[model samples]
Target: MASLSSLLPAPTQQVWDRDDERKAKRVGSALVVSQTSVPPYGQRKGWVPRAEEDFGDGGAFPEIHVAQYPLGMGARGKESTSNALAIIYSKLTDLLPSEVLAEDDPTLQKPDDEDIQDITEKTKLALEKLTNAKISAAMPVKAAPKAVS
Candidate 1:
């Protein structure tokens, strides 16, 4: 019998455990947050005074912010709303028995031969009807008579 690990990709061979070590390591990394503001320039004042340390071109803010979170955590934010939903979904799915999960999934079931034939016939009839309708709706074009040289 083949081991379950053998069935998984090499990188994911060891990720089947309840608490994935890789996920834990990722969660352990520090998360940093920063804010940036672009000062407006006026004819009289030139550029508004900003803290020397806080000042940066528009590009620096995103680079610093991305380096801090790296995984686009900013979109998701600290609330972890999506993460919580994902965890809930995973838990719900895990609670279902293997047989229920496998059998209840619509994509796993194959259509009967009769069902396939019926659908194919219906699709062909619909296409034919549409083609006929288009042909009927088209206006006949008259070719201009050739002029004598």
Candidate 2:
């Protein structure tokens, strides 16, 4: 089977989950939080001349970069994405029972109703909140008063 990348003009392969390379190793900011304005930039008269050496680029809190799968591609791409999203949906969102997820049951095939992974991103987020996944932590809210006080 051909990967989605093969069809592209310039195909590229992605290597996911290299936390060791991306995370900060020995940055000052990683150890200590320092908010310094270094002579307030514009004040030329009394500029306290100082050299600050920051070895690390604050990789401890690296910005997340995600590449989402194309929705309306083709059967091959759809199958791949469906499999991926199905796993996440089943595991994270608790759509399937623990037994099913653990491969204890033989009902792992895609359901006939709909492709579980073929839903919109919005629905996925909602599902995450519903399952109380760490990625989509739901805030606590008090119930509204039913009648007037």
User: Judged by lDDT, which candidate is best?
Assistant: 1
Clashes per candidate (backbone, < 3 Å): 0, 0
| Pairs of colliding residues, candidate 2 | none
Give a tens-digit lDDT track for model 1, residues 44-126.
23333234334453223432322333233443445664554453544777777665466667788899899899999999998
Candidate 2, TM-score vs. the true structure? Answer: 0.17
Candidate 2 per-residue lDDT over residues 21-124, each given as its tens digit: 55644442366757654333244354432323211222211122332122223423344444644435535547745532655455766555455555665698
Measured with C-alpha atoms, the lDDT of residue 83 in candidate 1 is 58
Scored by TM-score, the top model is 1
Q: What's the true lDDT of residue 124 in model 1?
A: 100
Can you tell me which runs of candidate 2 are displaced by over 4 Å?
4-20, 24-29, 33-36, 50-149
TM-score for each prediction?
0.26, 0.17
